[model samples]
Target chain A: MERWQVVTVVVAGYLLLTLLIGLFAGRRVSASVAGYVAADRQFGLLAQYFVTGAMIFSAFAFLGGPGWAYAQGAAVFYILSYGVLGIAPWYVLGPKAGRLGRRLGFVTQAQLVAGRFPSRSLSLLLALLSVAAFVPYIMLQMSGAGIVFRAVTDGHVPFWLGAAVSYLVVLVYVLFGGVAAVGWTNVFQGIIMMSVAWGLGLYIPIHLYGGVGAMFERIADARPELLTLPGLNAGGEPWSWGAYSSAILASALGFTLWPHLFMKSYTSRDDDTLRRTVILFPTFQLFLIPIFLVGFAGVLYPSPPEAPDFIMPHMILQTGLPALVVGLFCAGALSASMSTGDALMHAAASIAVEDGVRPYVRLTDAQQRLLMRALVVVVGAVAYYFAIVQKQTLVFLLLTAYGLVDQLAPPVYAALFWKRATTPGVLAGLAAGIGADLFFFWQRDLRPFDLHEGILGALANTLVLVVVSLFTAPQPEAHATVYVEPEEEAAGATVEAVA
Target chain B: MRARTARRLAIAFFALYALVLTYPGVLPFNRIRPLVFGLPFIMFWVALWVALAGVTLWLTHLAARRERRGR
Candidate 1:
């Protein structure tokens, strides 16, 4: 058989297995919205861990990560830095949020925020912002899938067809199986992605340039700038310490705030499951070190790909590795892309139906499920269209939006820890943050020691929230304390039981 | 393994990780002249912290588990 045929055979087999996993995992799903959206809160330790890790790593970790290392060198370390710091805070927050979720029956972040603040308008605003955020986010994953498909097939599969095919499988399993589909598939995909990544990551360098050390050592002798800290900025100029430092901070702050990921609180079996997931996340984050090795392996090679993001697949193809390895590499890339893409599509549709539409129009459980299923299709189509038609602009938008996610940090912290936070204060803070984000984004400028636009926005958000909340009478102490100090509620329950 | 202690451990754990990512920018750990384990000083520094983070969180998890049992 021809080499491409072997690749086709391997990738085809991988896709079929993904579909089967998707279908098999949902056998226990009950006939209710909770079953569909929250996986009946039954995820175990390992599944929860992989679901969280695989979702966070995404296509970016597999494809874009290597691309960054190949192109920007040490700059990619910032990606690794933010992931651990960002998720560590979840250990404190997740169990508390999960307890509150059980009590309040909130499955979306907006629902949780709105429940605390007691504002439908706030829920409406959050619902809108989530879609705005998810569009580009999901599009990024789809575009990654498309790029991998086109490159792997040597353009036999065009961007549109490739994206549509992968996402078509995603929508089917996600439609049939909600959180279970996402969870089980992540377990399977995470295994494939991590193994393929480590194998290829070490193999390419050792085969081409002796080993990881030799590759970097050779690069240091030839092109020295790539190894320097606060490496080149996105524009290829020497990155300032100020900008590099804040980008790392902003990324960490924004990491867990994504509504897509946050909604998983309702899916955890208990607080311990969520906490264990957070504690074990660093193990998953370490996979990036190998991914970066793959990228750095591409440097100083006489010929280079047209773009940094293409390095992983390009090197795989060019190095003339066995067809089996190339095929596994393709599956690995697809695993990364589809794993995250499915979750994004799933979350966005759930938010649209539960938070956005249901509040405006009352719907029964069956109707809600139907609407959410229909929305999965609609949302996927729109993102797929954008993925094929406008890849560059959407990715640019995604980069800008990471900072905007930091805007959620202030309100979330208030809900979890501070008692005096008010509804109006959060609204003011959110608006101020988004406005600050836009102003800096349009100017393409980092401000105040080159802190990320998100961090800058968050600073403004916090200031507005504090000034407004102090002036406004705090939400009644009883209402505020329910979320602010859930431990009190637990103690009250114990007291009642004793009586 | 008091719950309070486990909570504090979690906080300290992240604080140490943040310091590694943050101080490196200010202090500039990017020297490649000396390769530790075939990685640049900065790269090795970050990688070392990642492994340390795994060990740290694992201990915290154990502490948290023991705290639950003690309760």
Candidate 2:
């Protein structure tokens, strides 16, 4: 067979395998809303481990990670620094949230927070913000997939067709199986992504530059700036320490609060499973080391990719590796894109129906499930449209999304940890935080020391939450105790905490 | 270790980890030469901290488990 044709066959086989696994995984869950949204809360440690890890290592990490390393230098280290910082908190918060999820039958993050605050507006606001943040993120993933397909196929598969075909598979599995499909598919995709990353990451440097150390040595000799911290900005100018540091802080803080990831707190079977997942996250996180190495491998190459994000696929094609390896690389890239896309679509839809629509409009479980499935398709189509048609640089939207989600941190901490946090306090804080974040985001020149807007927003949000809570009447003692101490604490010594 | 102590230690460890990796704390270690594990010093520094975070978490997990058993 011709080379591209053989690669096409391999990719086709991989997609078919993912589709079958997703369809079969769907059969494992019940028909209830919990079953669809939280996989019946039955995922063990292994499933939880992969689901969380794979969801975090999105197309952005796979493609943009290398892109950042190749173009922006040590700017990519910010990505490396943030994962463990973000997930370690989950060791405590996940189980606490899980206990509440079981007690109150909450399926989404908004439900958990609003269950404490008890505000319809809060729930609607969270749902809208999550969906809005999700659209650009999902668009990034879709375009990431399109970029890989177009690169690997030598333009035979256009960006639109590649994205549509791949995401159509994602839609089928997600619509059919819900979170269960996402979990199972992530396991399969996670393995592929890690293995491909390590294989190529090590092989490329060794193949081109003799060894990993040797590659860095050459770059240090030639382009010394790329080897240092804070690295370079998008315009290839030296990056500010303020930008670099705040990116890590803001991303780490906002990491678990992303609606898609936060909802995973409701999926684990037990507290131990949740705790172990957090412990093992660092191992999965180390995968970025190889990812960055691959980008560094591209630094001194003769031919440049059309864009920085295309460096990985471009390098693979240029190296003239066997078609099978190229095809597998394509599959790995798709895995990164699809794994996260499925989770985002599933969470956005669930949040929309459960927290957004269900609060104002009462719906039966059957109706809720139907509406969520419909919303999934709607969200997918919208993102796909932006991915193929507009093809806008979504960096602005992605940053704004993180800043917006970071605003959720105060409300969440208030709900689970602080006894005196009033609903009005949480609401007011969210508005102020988002407002400050947007203001700084637009007026970059006014930012103090080039700090990320998310960091500024978080500070504003926390300050408002505290001050407003002090001014407002505390939640009624009896109602607040359910969240502050919980009824189980009265019965015996329990380790329930949100620390 | 007591459960509360374990939790407190874990919190302190992470707090330190975050502090050490950001801005001024990271400035000292952010260099190109003196590669460790065939990686840049700054990159390796971040990875070392991440590994330590895992160990700290495991220790805390063990402490919490012991507390549960004692209860």
Q: Report the number of the highest-DockQ candidate.
A: 2
- lDDT of prediction 1: 0.83
Compose the digit string of candidate 1's lDDT tens values, residues A1-499.
8777788789889999999999999777887888888888788898898889889878878878888777777777888778878887787778888889888888888888888987778888888888887888888888888878778778888878778888889999999988899999999999999999889888888889987888888999987888877777657788777777777788889888898888887899999899889878888988898888888888877789767777888888988899998899889888988888899899989999888887789899999999999999999999888777774632244556687788889989988888888899999999999899778866655466776788888999999998999999877777878898888877988999999
Stretches of candidate 2 exceeding 4 Å from the true structure = A390-397, A487-499
Residue-wise lDDT of candidate 2 within A366-451, one digit each (tens)?
99999999999999999988887754443444666788889889998888889999998999999999899989988999999999
Give the CAPRI class of candidate 2. Answer: high
Worst 10 residues of 1 chain A by lDDT: A391-400
lDDT, each prediction: 0.83, 0.90
What is the lDDT, from 0 to 100, of the residue A81 in candidate 1? Answer: 78
Error of 2 at A398 (Å): 3.5
DockQ of 1: 0.67
DockQ of each candidate, alpha-carbon based:
0.67, 0.83
Q: Native-contact recovery for every candidate?
A: 0.62, 0.74
Q: Which structure among the candidates has the greatest lDDT? A: 2
